[model samples]
Target: MNKNLIIGQFTDAYLPITDGVVLTVKNYAHWIEKKYGKCIVICPSFPKFIDEDNFDIIRFFSIPMPLRPPYRMGIHYLDLKAIKRVEKIPFHIVHAHSPFSAGLFALETARKRKVPIVATFHTKYYDDFKSATKSDFLARIGVDIIVKFYEKVDQVWTVNSSTAKTLKEYGFKKEIEIIPNGTDIIPPENLEEYKEKINKIYNLSQDDNVFLYVGQLILHKNIKMLIESLYYLKMKGFSFKFLIVGTGKDEKYLKDLVRKLKLDKEVIFVGRIIDRELLKGFYARADLFLFPSLYDASPLVLQEAFALSCPSLLIKGSNASEGIIDGYNGFLSENNAISYANMIEKLIKNKPLLREVGKNAQKTLYRPWEKVIDEVVERYKELIFTYKKNF
Candidate 1:
């Protein structure tokens, strides 16, 4: 809560383009200003997106990625213009939310200012790159870039041990602190009304079992397997509403898969829901959260689901499924469509068990943002003091 400690955080994405990385930067920036000192957010500038918060922000010019239009890539260089802008902010620490373009900018500023830098390994870039390009060679290049990016940082943090192991496997030798992402949402006061709204809009009866997947509609999230699982369910004559929220580069591919599988009636692609109340409403309407991503490190979606008492159904040993006990907080399946189909079919039959597990999921939501961000800020404090002492 020291006002003297100024921090500059860098991220590649922000609002109007929601993901874990963007949400992480926003939440930390918002809470850091509320408690610690001022936190300045440096992100890519997109057209028509204005600075809409009380926090300090510096946006650099960025353009939409050709392959992935939803993503805006920063075009900042370490020239006089970049240096001039970074020099304006007197920050004690430089925190990079990603290890890409904005991260490189943060590294440059930290090097120029002789300040400590920290980075959070938010995603499995190898999988992300592979999904984007469908090329292992490019994914290897991405792994190399990630390795080199973290080499210059003073401290590294992540959300789970599986991802920490993945980082080590990718040639990063530094120690990584595992700070699980927190979920902070004020549940809609009228939950039943929200449910009714969603049911009416989606053309579903209140008796239908709603299964939800609430993140990017991409390959690495195992969305293809989810779609296949739905096909298997339909074959078995199961009746349920599968809600596909959020959009990504693979929207067309996933949609085509749904059509090919003839799941047009069961699956509903709601696109990206930016409104928090509507999002929370969809979360409340669902009976289960179906997420079976193998390449993740404690996805915030799981926490969001848990916060709303919506138990997640994920694959065993998947990073996002960590801490989720099978049949307790969530149901764990194998890395196959048949297994997911079996789990969904079984859970659909036992509605009482679904509610019971959902109740158990709430047990994992007691950790407040106040505690999570305190640990994060404490690390910033330690890294800064250590940097000053060593220098």
Candidate 2:
């Protein structure tokens, strides 16, 4: 709790993207500045997107990433203007959310300042590389670079134990600290009001079963499996409404698949919502959240849904489903469409079970950013103390 501690948060992702890592870094910057000390966010610039946070944001030069739309590749070293601006800030300890250009810049800054640096491993990088490059050899090389980056950092962190294990699998042999992601939302008091509003907007009724998925519409997130499972659910003569609330690289392919499966009427894509309250309304309206992603190490959307008392049905044994218990706080199904469909069919009919599980999810899963950042700043303090003593 050093009020004079000025922290640097470096990342490749930021505003207008709305992914988990961006949200994580944003919350970290927000809460740290509010309660502890000054925090500056350093990330790649998104064209025409003005940052309006209480804390300062320093954006560097960037170019659009072809494979990942809306996310730019930062060329931090080339941005002399940004470099000169950041040079004046007195950063005590720096944190990197990505090992790309922004992270390297953070590493350089930490070295120049003679301060400890922390790097958080947040994603399954191998999957991302293989998806973009379509080569296992290239993917392995990418993971090797990721491991080398973590090895260079003063401290390494992951969102959960499963994520730590993932880093270990990727050949990082160092110790990792677990700092779980937190949601900014809480259970809405007027849940019924939001549910009614969503029902009217989407042409749904009180009795109709509504399921939701609010993330990138990409194959890597196993969105294909979700669409196929819904096709099976329809084939089994069930009536339901599905709302997919995000856009991604595979949006066209996923939409085409839904058309091929004749699920056009049942599935609705509410693309890229920025309003948290509006998103919460969708969560409030959902009977269950369907997220079967094996790609995500730990998804913030899952916790967001749970905060609104909406339970999720995740893939059995998947990393995102690590802390979930089947048929208790949440539901789990086998990785295939048939098994997922079968589980959905059973749950859609039992209203009592759905309500009970949703309540349990709210109790077990919702951890607010305020509580999570208290722990984070304390860790920052410890790292600073130990690092300075040793130095």
Residue-level lDDT of model 2, residues 315-372, one tens digit each, is 9888899889888899999999999999999998997898899889889878999999
Off by over 4 Å in 2: none
- Say which candidate scores most in lDDT: 2
Cα lDDT for residue 261, candidate 2? 97
Residue pairs with colliding backbones in model 2 are: none
Per-candidate clashes, comma-separated = 0, 0
Tens digits of per-residue lDDT, candidate 1, 1-391, equal 2666789989989876788888888889888998888988888888987788779888887878887777889877733565577788878999998898889999989988999999989888887788778899989988998899998899898887888888998899878888878877744457789788888888888899899999987777889998999899999988888999998888999999999999998899998887777887787889888998887787777777776777779999877777878887789999999999999999888878888898788776434566788898888888888999999
Query: Looking at model 2, which ten-residue stretch has the lowest summed lDDT?
Result: 1-10
List RMSD in Å for every model shown.
Answer: 1.9, 0.9
lDDT of 2 at 306: 83
